[model samples]
Target: MWKWETEEHAKAVVVIIHSAFEHHRWYAWLIEKLRVEGYHVVMGDLPGHGEEGKYSRIHDETVNEYIKYIKNLMESALSYELPVYMIGHGLGGTLAVHYLKKNKVACAGVILSSPWFALQKHGSLIKSALANLGSLTSNMKLTLDINKKALTNNLQGYQEMDDNLVYKTNVTVSWYKEIQLIMKNLFVPSTSQLAIPILLMTAKQDKITDVEQARKWLLLQSSTEFQFKEWPLSYHNLFHDLEREQVFMYVRDFINNTTRGLGYIID
Candidate 1:
């Protein structure tokens, strides 16, 4: 767990949840920027991420377990006794949605960046079906074929990803099975509507998550105040792309404006 505070008072505390196969250290750059903006920030490493959990070995985990982890981590920020907001990336973003819907957390708002609400197909239907069936064994391990180029548009970013310390390339069948169940529930609207504000950021060139599908599901939620920003010239990892500073600026401006009750009007 890591927390950064500014001398000046902050409107709200922001908890950052990093993407899949990554740890809290990976978000240092973004955290520093948040601190510079005078926002209190808290971050943590997920169960299967960080140095303790290596890519060569991944545990069998379910959707429920992932949600439990997220809830526990957010409790640290809750101790501050301030309105807490969440900024989650990729898989972390999906977990945030599940956490918000299930628990009555006193969060003021949320930001989801390239959330994996829907997945892109990498192979034929038969192969996909086999993999899904294979997950029933629980011990089955599937190799992930991550295209480095799809991670970011910047050449330097691509090289850095190749050498990333906490990167995971192997996923367990049970993990995929659990993720499928979570995705199914997300597509269907919830009975109790979400009341807090949301900012859903979609990548135009994302190769991992389905941006259109995410937009469609988000539009179905009518009870929440929300805004959607489609970032162009970006891949799945928008912040690690060539135009990272611009992306960070957009997020900073959003949080600042939201704090002052000057949220950007929907187009």
Candidate 2:
């Protein structure tokens, strides 16, 4: 189900997508901020996380399945007769990119916060290759979430979040493979037929996704309307970082600027 807040004079709709092991509540502050600013805010739980039933481990999910969920959500919002904008973090960010590439999903713009384009630290190519082999041979439950430092540094509040609210962080081999496929598609040309603006945030000290790779991907874009910000003092989860207020300001400015230009937002 979707939870939403609309101001009396709302002008635009903003949809917040959660990270891989997290629920939609991760964007609770952002949603409230947007609603207070007269923008309608909508968020929902994705399959295998939050309110949705866990179908299988992370690796077991196919990209098509994830895309279907996003498409259905976007369609449902369109049914309500509202202009939609997308804001996604981590794996959710990657899913947003896939959605923009595949469909003419109407949106004023898109905001990506430290999207998981490439895992900076993890299994080697040889290990992944072997895992692929094993996956083909047997239905092995690849226990891939071994990174204890995931919620450290920038994500200090992660520990405060209940384990059940956020996922306990276990993944399978197929999930890693799915991530690899998504990353591979990143370097390919952008298929968005719409000239919707894009905002991408990267953490300078992030240990999870490869910041440099994200930079390279952004550079490949021919559109100059895109905005890129690198937070030198922040880590992976920019929204929950110690300097999160600054990050939120960045987010607010981007949304305000682009939507104002389109005449869909004011102030």
Best by lDDT: 1
Query: What TM-score does prediction 2 earn?
Result: 0.86
Give the per-residue lDDT of model 1 (tens digit) for 80-100: 877678998988888888888
TM-score of each: 0.88, 0.86
Candidate 2 residue spans exceeding 4 A from truth: 53-59, 80-82, 123-138, 146-149, 152-156, 190-194
**lDDT per residue (tens digit) for residues 1-267 in model 2:** 475666557667777777777777666667776777767776787667765544444435567877888887777666656667788888888888878877876677888899988877654335656545544523444454424356446444555444554354665656666777888887877555325788899888787888888878777765568989999877788877767788888877887788678766464
Instruction: Write down the RMSD of candidate 1 (Cα, Å).
Output: 3.6
